[model samples]
Target chain A: MIILGVDPGLTRCGVGVIEAGAYRRLSFIHVDVVRSDPKSPQDRRLLTIYDGLAAKLDEFAPDVVSIERVFAQENRNTVLGTAQAAGMAMLAAAQRNIPVALHTPTESKMAITGNGKAEKIQMERMVARILNLNTLPKPADAADALAIAICHALRPAGAIQGGEREEHLTAAQRQWAKAAQKASRGRTQGRAM
Target chain B: MIILGVDPGLTRCGVGVIEAGAYRRLSFIHVDVVRSDPKSPQDRRLLTIYDGLAAKLDEFAPDVVSIERVFAQENRNTVLGTAQAAGMAMLAAAQRNIPVALHTPTESKMAITGNGKAEKIQMERMVARILNLNTLPKPADAADALAIAICHALRPAGAIQGGEREEHLTAAQRQWAKAAQKASRGRTQGRAM
Candidate 1:
């Protein structure tokens, strides 16, 4: 499966994709959406992000998209920008009908490293090691994007492709997919009813 | 005076400088830092950002460095990466003792266009028109960086430098500088104080 990991931002978005299997293929792309003109309305910033990301999605078509989940910060302004960037990524994935998985910082770190609270240096080292690259990825943004994709690759296959909806399923696969489907239904019904 | 505008990232930091007055000069330099090894640590990423940016600052010896401020978003991941990118810019400028000036989207737009809310196409057109370039700046990031420096040039002398000081008084001639400084104060103080 082809998985695209996104590091969304108002000014720049980092994207990396990895194909699952022993001989995996990887591609890294960074999209910069220069913020809208100050003379323009605030809403235009969103549009700029939208258009920029859409162009990127068009260029890199992937089966799955993984984005880092939002984390709390002290700055409201920073949080707002993060939200806008995340929203843009979600919109892109939804528009393309691509399944998306949100990976937390800790989850990505733990997957890359043995520890969840791994320092930036540690995570970079682990990412480089996992990818069998000669040097660490330059620009932490790119590394983080790659790391998110790595995290998704390590997830259960059913969690990603909707286990129940699979056209063909082994007996064991069906058991897991059925349970997952039931759980999803229970959560949805819990919310609806 | 020549002002170098840098968009610092680990992989690629867009560099552009513009000098005004009797002899006008405009050049766009792209610095690419790629680590072939995936297992490298995150500190290595920052180091690459530092080494690449420092070389440019030395080679160009810009009078001032104008940069884009890091704004937050809903995606904690993007915020972290952009913050790192902005931090790299700040460190590179501060290391050279090259006065740093930050321009917001609005101020940059206003300087390029009469309105703060001008569209990206409008700002790109204006950047090309004002600079008398035959074509639009390739890679919007480069254009945005140049636009920022152009904005700085149009502002009153010493506006950006003076505004860097927290206790400074605003100068009417540098309204954009004053406003940008005021907005950046909260984040700047965290680093300075």
Candidate 2:
């Protein structure tokens, strides 16, 4: 399965595409950052993000799209922009009938580095290692996008299995698990991205 | 000039169209609400909003689009959805090269009732009176939307002219003026919605 991952942002949106090979092997297809002029109108910037991602979807044609989910606790000034960018990405994916998965930042870190609280550098290093890349992905946003895709690529087979394991998790871990479950519920229920 | 005004929301988005005739006479063209099922996935809901608004823009072909400018202080749970919906409205307008204008709640209230703190019923009554509608617009959202369009229609010719009048304003009024000016700046500067 090919996955398109989006690190949604207003000024700079990161997009990464990866193909899952036999035995869970992954190969990179494309990675890039779509930048919008901060000087542009908010709606125009959003349109730039939307048009950029729509073009990428057309070019890459990934089977599924994964994006970071926005939470209220994020930086207030940028949260709305990020959410709008994510909304654009989801809209692009939905327009094409591609399934969308939302992964939280902690879930992405855990997927890449086996620790929900892994530092950015560690997460980047692990993404490089997992993808067998000699060099790290340029721009932290791009690496972050790749990490989101990897999380979806390595997601557990079923929520039932994940739920069964949740009983053993700590409170914080359980919270993350529940949030992830709520996000992933969209995959099955055809609910909001 | 024609204006399309949107009261952006996730569950129910209000849309109104009005024509600004010579001598500033206003006539209502259309008003209604676009709703999305809460049970639908986030992406699906956004698409429903985008598609609905896109269709309106196509049919109305308004000269400009006006929408409520989102503030960070709004209800936390619904703010992101509202922002995303507003972004969709802006995108629809931008796609058609329609000039987009944003008005705050205070601005809309003030424009309709000559008082920034006017109650909903007051704003609705003024909207009905301004449009010469015998019956009040059903659904408060639609009336709110008509107020936004009317605000745009009656807006001063330029910010510089409004700024000249700011010396006579109260502290709270000056603050709202500044916010409105900043938002209007984005329209000309091509800044984010």
RMSD of each: 14.9, 4.2
- Residues forming the 10-long window of minimal summed lDDT in candidate 1 chain B: B30-39
Q: Which portions of model 1 show Cα errors greater than 4 Å?
A: A1-193, B10-12, B22-41, B73-76, B157-193
Estimate, for each residue in A66-95, the C-alpha lDDT of model 1 and write its tens digit: 877654443545454554465556656665
Give me the runs in candidate 2 sitting further than 4 Å from their true place.
A160-193, B160-193
What's model 1's lDDT at B16? 69
The count of residue-pair clashes in candidate 1 stands at 34
- Each model's TM-score for chain A is 0.70, 0.85
**What would the per-residue lDDT of candidate 2 be over residues A1-193, giving only the tens digit for each residue?**
8999999999999999899998999988789999999888777888899999999999999999999887654535677788889999988999999988888787787666767789999988998888888888887769999999998887654432564566666655565566567656644442233
Looking at model 1, residue B190 earns an lDDT score of 32
Interface RMSD of each: 14.9, 5.2
lDDT, each prediction: 0.60, 0.81
